[model samples]
Target: MNDNDVVRDLTLDGNAVAGLLEEVFGADMTTADGECAHCGSANAVGALRAYTRAPGVVLRCPACGGVIARIVQTPRGTLVDLRGAAHLAMRR
Candidate 1:
């Protein structure tokens, strides 16, 4: 399948989204203010606002304004990638 097809067909539930957020942020999905394990910054709020607005959307760090992470949900579980943040340069 083409990239467009894959993007159009991806589906995720709330539970999966929550799991992804937890895995990435190490806190509840709705709360904010978690430590960014990468940069050691106190501004890692889980970015729940960004997540809820766009369920599978990844967000950049508001403090550093860098692409520090992503969130994805699948049948297996939620996936978070802190290493994606270009500025942090740290892994979870």
Candidate 2:
């Protein structure tokens, strides 16, 4: 997708977007290594591991721990938010 497309569709806050990406891409359970596009970090063991929990799924820089934006796929096409079963928390 182009930058304009991303700006229009995934305009939500960064953290929310991160969570959404994680859910959509199965980041939490991912076992593959991914490079952080921002800081060029190569520490993403899984999809979720590439992000930081503090900022609510903010993509972390593997080399410098910087935050980066991530894109995820969905039934409605590519999305920037975590709106799947994985992102949902169980209620007590």
Candidate 3:
């Protein structure tokens, strides 16, 4: 298997997390603009590839496959790690 195959097998479009994002962000954020910190790739939050088989949701840049964000739900609360994202512009 190749990188593309692996990626395909492990990921889904960011839309899969629409409800989770709305819950975390307090609004529909699927159409939000996002910039990847790792590769400088820009795309809609909904356009990013999402890997949900982990303990949390891992969103990645589709162009470069760099992680853009990670959202985890813990008993304490939700943990949003955006270290992989340079910017996220959500519409009002």
* Candidate of highest lDDT: 3
Q: Write the per-residue lDDT of candidate 1 for residues 1-92, one digit (tens) a residue.
A: 99967643553323445555567656564344445444555543444224334656655454444545566777787777767343322232
Question: How do the predictions measure up, each by TM-score?
Answer: 0.39, 0.34, 0.89
Single out the weakest 10-residue window by summed lDDT for candidate 2. Answer: 83-92
Provide the lDDT at 56 for model 2: 38
**In angstroms, what RMSD does candidate 1 have relative to the true structure?**
9.0
Task: Order the numbered candidates by lDDT, best leading.
Answer: 3, 1, 2
Give the per-residue lDDT of model 3 (tens digit) for 1-92: 99989868987988999999999989988999999998887899999999999899999999998888899998999999999999999887
Tell me how candidate 1 scores on lDDT. 0.49
Best by TM-score: 3
Tell me the TM-score of model 1. Answer: 0.39
Cα error, candidate 1, residue 9 (Å): 25
List per-prediction Cα lDDT, in the order shown.
0.49, 0.42, 0.91
> In model 1, how large is the Cα lDDT of residue 20?
55
